[model samples]
Structure formats: C-alpha cells, structure tokens
Target: MATEDLMRKALEALGEVNGPMSIEVIHRLVDAGDVEDPMSIAEVSDLLDVSAHTLRYYEKIGLVTVDRDSSGHRVYGPESVRRLVFLTRMRISGMAIRDLQHYVELVDAGEGTVPE
Candidate 1:
C-alpha cells in the first residue's frame, strides 16, 4: 500500500475520535492525536454512546475542567479524556450523581474530605 493510503487508513481508524469533541479537554486530546492522551468528546461519545449534553453537565458541575485553546475553544488532554471514560463507567456501575459530585469535590480539595 502507498504511504498516503496507509496514513489515510490510520486516520480513518481514528473514527469519531477525530473531531466534534463535545468537551474542551476531549478536543485537546483529539487535537493531540496520540494514544497517550484521551480521544475527543466525539470519539468518547462514539465509543460510549453518550450525548454531548452529558459531558457539558459534567463540566458545569465541576466534575470536569476542559482547558481552552487560544481561540477560547475547549481543549481536552489525555487525563480529562481518561477521566471521562472512568466517570461514564462509574455511572454504569450505579454510582449516584451525588456520590459522583462528592468524589469530584474530594478531588478538587486535593484528595481530602471533610471527614464523615
């Protein structure tokens, strides 16, 4: 196969992970275009079948922070993308929304909680 054709196939393998990342962090991951990072929101959505609004809500409630690009666009790095996958999986495991929020709060507080 030609080099160009191989590259094209590789990009195609990227699939929905390629563009339309719903969250900033996810976008950054996709933009980064490396396995070391997370894929874009579009990729995550395609991978997990979740809606963009769900991710937006996660950001709204401080569950996720998507860094912005110079153009004021959200950029998602590998960590954020990985976190998304984890959170999505947690939801699937019957984790309550409040628990998730608490977990996020602990993370925000540098892994310390107010104690039971």
Candidate 2:
C-alpha cells in the first residue's frame, strides 16, 4: 500500500482511541517505511507538505540537524525526517516557534526531562 494510504488508515485508527496519545504512537503510525532512504530537502518538503524555505528555517533555528551531501546539498536522514514530522504536526497543532524551540531543547537534554 502507499504511504499516504497507510497514514490515512493510521490516523483513522488513532481517532478511535480515547485519552492522551504519546508521540511514539503517532511516530509508528506515520513512519511507513520511508525512513530507509535518505532524502533531499525537496523530497522532505513534499512529504511533509512544507516548503523548502521552512525546512531551511527549521535547520537554521536548530530545530533539526540535516547532513550535507558531497556537493553540499542538504540530505535528511531517517531521524531528521522523523523529527520534521513531529515538528510539522506540532506546528499544525498551533505550537509557537519559541515553544517548539524550548521543547526541542528539552528533548535534546535527554529522557530524564520527560516531565518538563
């Protein structure tokens, strides 16, 4: 099945669940095998439905860390793509940039800060 189809079905399943859902649940639902290959900025932008400029801005603001290919173009790995997915979702849910930044900082600080 297509990734989009899988995501749609996953979302439908999620909607049926009651109570607070963790990010890991959503991650598993949306991951859908696209993480196996590294993608360019354009590919990530298209997959996440965000613009290249926004991706660049995210990177610039330290929200994500993307590697560069041999020719110096951005290459997003699985983890980076996963992070972007979470970031985009949070943005869609109305998270402010500063709050997102702080959240990322807490996340980067490690699992010990989970309560924060």
Candidate 3:
C-alpha cells in the first residue's frame, strides 16, 4: 500500500479509540493494513507533519530509535511511525520533555513499569 494510505488507515483507527491509545493499539492499527515496505525519513517526516531535523532530534534525544537501511539511509517502519505519532501528540498535549523521556525509559524497561 502507499504510505499515505497506510497513514490514513492508522488515523481512522486512532479516531475510533475512546481514550489514549497505547503502543500496542497503534501497532494493531498499522498491522491491520499491509504496507509494501518501510518508509524513508523524508516520507515519515511528511506523513507526521514533522521536519527531518525534528525527526533526527527525536532520535538523538532517545525519544525514538530509527533503523537505517543497507545504504545507511534512515528507514521508518510501521512501529517507528506509530512512535512518532504518539510522541508528536504528546508534545502537542504539552507533555514535558523530561516526562516524555522518563515515560520512554519506563516503556523500554518493560511491562513492570505499567503497574507503577
């Protein structure tokens, strides 16, 4: 599927949720539709309405981890896109950087942090 189509499906699914959607939920939404392949950094930036600089900054700050293809160009898969969506929404909602960082650390730490 086209990148735009994939994003559309994800947004449609996102709108159906009553409350905050977790990473798992977002994953399910993205997985519901098949993407032909991973998207490039520029494509992801356009889709998320974020700048390439901001996307790089997110990776630099550990907010997100972007995997590179064989040619060393950044490739954003569905999971990475979902993460960017979540991060962008949080920022728009006024979530502090420190808190977002902490939350990301908690998430990286695993499910145990969910109960804390």
Best by lDDT: 2
In order of lDDT, best first, we have 2, 3, 1
Residue 19 displacement in candidate 1 (angstroms): 26
lDDT of each: 0.64, 0.79, 0.74
Q: After the best TM-score superposition of candidate 1, give how far the Cα of residue 26 lies from its true spot, in angstroms.
A: 19
Per-candidate TM equals 0.59, 0.72, 0.68
Which tens-of-lDDT digit does each residue in 1-116 have in candidate 3?
97656755665575733444444444444453344468888877666656899999999999998899889999987777777778877774569989989999999999999985
The TM-score of candidate 1 is: 0.59
Candidate 2: regions farther than 4 A off: 1-34
RMSD of each: 10.7, 7.5, 8.8
The stretch of ten residues in a row with the least summed lDDT in candidate 2 is 16-25
lDDT value for candidate 2?
0.79
Summing lDDT over every window of 10 consecutive residues in candidate 1, give the lowest-scoring window: 21-30
In the range 35-78, model 1's lDDT, one tens digit per residue, is 46535667655555567788878888888888776776566676
Steric overlap count per candidate: 9, 0, 0
In angstroms, give how far residue 68 of model 2 lies from its true place: 0.5
- C-alpha positional error of residue 62 in candidate 3 after TM-score superposition, expressed in Å: 0.7
